[model samples]
Target chain A: MKKSSLILASAGALLLMAGVYLAFFVAPDAVVRIDDRELVRYSQKIFYFHVPVAETSFVFLLLGGLFGAMYLGTRKRSYEQMSYAAVEVGFIFVLLVMITGVLWTRADWGVWWEWEPRLTTFLVLTLMYSGYFVLRSSVQEESAKARFGAIFSIIAAVNVPLTFVAGRLDSLKPVHPTVFTLQGASMEGPMLAAFLVSMFGMLLFATSLYIMRLDLLRAREDIEYLKEELEVG
Target chain B: MAAGKQVFAIVKKDVLAELRTKEMVIAMLLFVILAMVVFSQAFGVILNDLDRVGGGLLWVAFLFMSMLGLNRSFVHEKDEGCLEGLLMSPIDRPLIFFGKMLGNLLFLSIVELFAVPIFFVLFRLELGASMAGIFLATIFLSNVGIASVGTLLSTISINTKTRDLMLPILFLPVIIPLLIAAVSATGGIMSGEELTEVYRSMRFIAVYDIIFLLVAYALYDYVISE
Candidate 1:
């Protein structure tokens, strides 16, 4: 990583650690009442990390789509690299969201998975972006690969939100389908502070990673260009 | 000639080709019917209360069968250099997309028309006469969404190396939302549920179709161009 990205990444790591400390040590435990019993819900702690990660993934994917459209409109190589890097970073976050989401569900709901609206939407989003990589690999031509990838990214971005909306429809007859209760509903001052810290940290960390990946992609292209120049000379 | 005329000419050519060969529709019909039979044997017992779940089987069969047809739709154009010819012609790229989409929509509807009746008979279910129009409307709207998105994606997939295998990978995920809405609507209609709920799903399918159609329209030129 370059100096700027390294610094950003370090700051992000520090804030995230602080967020963790605040979340566990400072924030009051979430209490759930079962009939007459008050019980501390430990799994609620995961909310600080899980929600921020999920939101960060969505932002990156949305940026992936926006950058893709920009690349398509301009046919600029820099835009294409930015688009690809965004999707790649966004894809990592998407998987992290999936894993954390599953663990959270299992911990809180005592089930491995639920076909709830939010989960179902995220599942489809995962599948769609997975298709994006498959699509990028299937084409051999360079410009065509970039073009197709950009197009699919834009489609997937648009389609992900639509999938979320569609999930809310009673069409899947979701066993009285309701979205999983977002656990952040009970946040107090400490919890809020921790969440904000984590959210900013996650965003900065993701941006740093995106920049690093973008630089790597551009460097790879440059090396290829240099090799071609030597071969021609 | 007018854009409408050009589009119709493209559609007409596909119709004539299909009429002459009877290949795409016949194979689709065969695949669809066989899939229903497979469903019966696979889920042989306790399928009696299949009204609600029947939507799942029906869509899986149609979605796959549509992919088969969609791949075939573009294979001929690409194999015979017809896509190049289409590009070289005077018609607009978006017009070409609409033309091909209409052709696909027609074929999918026809196959479903035959297959759905056979599905009802084999499964021993009656949609009752009154709800037939609504059921068909749901199927038709779903088909429109399928054809629009399928046509656009199929155009892209055919250009890639893994021509035959690529369409399903790209198309299925993109179409899942529409599929969910379709299943909800059809299931609602079959279970003799509220008309209002069924209409909502149908409206969703319609919105999906319009959104994809507009997307394809704006993007097809870039897709088909070099």
Candidate 2:
């Protein structure tokens, strides 16, 4: 497990660095028409990383919920640990999405925040997952904590799509950048390549982090077990 | 038949218990009405116009008040060893969830039945009879979402160390989607928005309610089991 994570980490880092280079050099700058004048958006480059990170965050959150439901059914300790770890990793990417999203919005929209649909939904997503950790810590009994965490994760996951759709209400409006329409990828060739590379890189990197966190959690439990044995002996 | 009977028995027990104390219902009523008072005073300048944002105010008050009632619903069971008695009974675990959730729903509805009129009267917001019916229906739909999710979460929260404090943290986030839909539905009505828009929001609320109800039904067994 350790060796694989190290390998995955290096491969992911390499791909991510390549992705950055391609994004900066290969991808054309996005041009927006304001009053019929086309102005190149230098900040549009953040879209590559921002979008990949955002989508990756959704995948991790879905995995967290999947593992959570699995744990409930099987009553397995490892599945619960994976669920917890996935949520933790997913949360970090969500924060990154928010940061990059904010910077991009500031540059493009000229506002620090707008109650746009995707933005509002992501905000709700962040708050919902944050509650998962708080719920975990507040439970004293270990098994009960796992049980409750799993339950909340399942529900929170189910909410992701609902919040997203509700976010598109007429009042919230549709201000988020649209790239992948039903017509398909709205990007040129090199740009799509950069996006795909960054996306796979981000997924691999996140997977490694999840494995490392799971290993650490298991180690902590082992240490606890040893300490109890030592005290008894 | 047996499951229905068992669920009814649990609901009856909670209703009987509440009747004896009349504590939660009265407090919930007072809390909601007082919340409107606070909103009236705090948003004094804006109090004159409750058209655009009145739905949001009603929900803010209702959400907190619902949390208060939800927290209390489970505290007594855990404190008085009633939970053990229920567990010891031959009823299935999911039936217990339905029972407790229905009781919570009943109380929440009763509170809103009174609070909604007081909200309208106090705020002096007027709506036609037909509009009022839709408004009440929207609130009822949202109440189902709240009571179901609340019952499931309150059970989890009450078992934690910081039981009361834990609920809003857990409950509020999960309830945000419902809040959005409910507020939009009610706000649409208050602001004279299109009926189609209000119905769309109501439909989403119903969807949210049904999904959570299914999730709770599937998960409640693990939640209550020792």
- Alpha-carbon local distance difference test for all models: 0.89, 0.92
The residue-level lDDT of candidate 1 at B71 comes to: 92
User: What are the runs in model 1 whose C-alpha is more than 4 Å off?
Assistant: A171-186
**CAPRI grade of model 1:** medium
TM-score of chain B of each: 0.98, 0.98
lDDT of 2 by residue, B141-173 (tens): 999999999999999999999888899988988
- Tell how far residue A127 is off in model 1, in angstroms: 1.5
* TM-score, candidate 1, first chain: 0.93
RMSD of each: 2.2, 1.4
Candidate 1 per-residue lDDT, tens place, B1-226, comes to 7999999999999999999999999999999999998988899775877987888889999999999999999999999999999999989778999899999999999999999999898888897788999989899999999999999899899999898888888999999999989999998988999999898888888888889899877777778886
Which one wins on TM-score? 2
Per-model TM values vs. the true structure: 0.96, 0.97
Report the C-alpha displacement of residue A73, candidate 2, in angstroms. 0.6
Query: What is the two-chain DockQ of model 1?
Result: 0.78
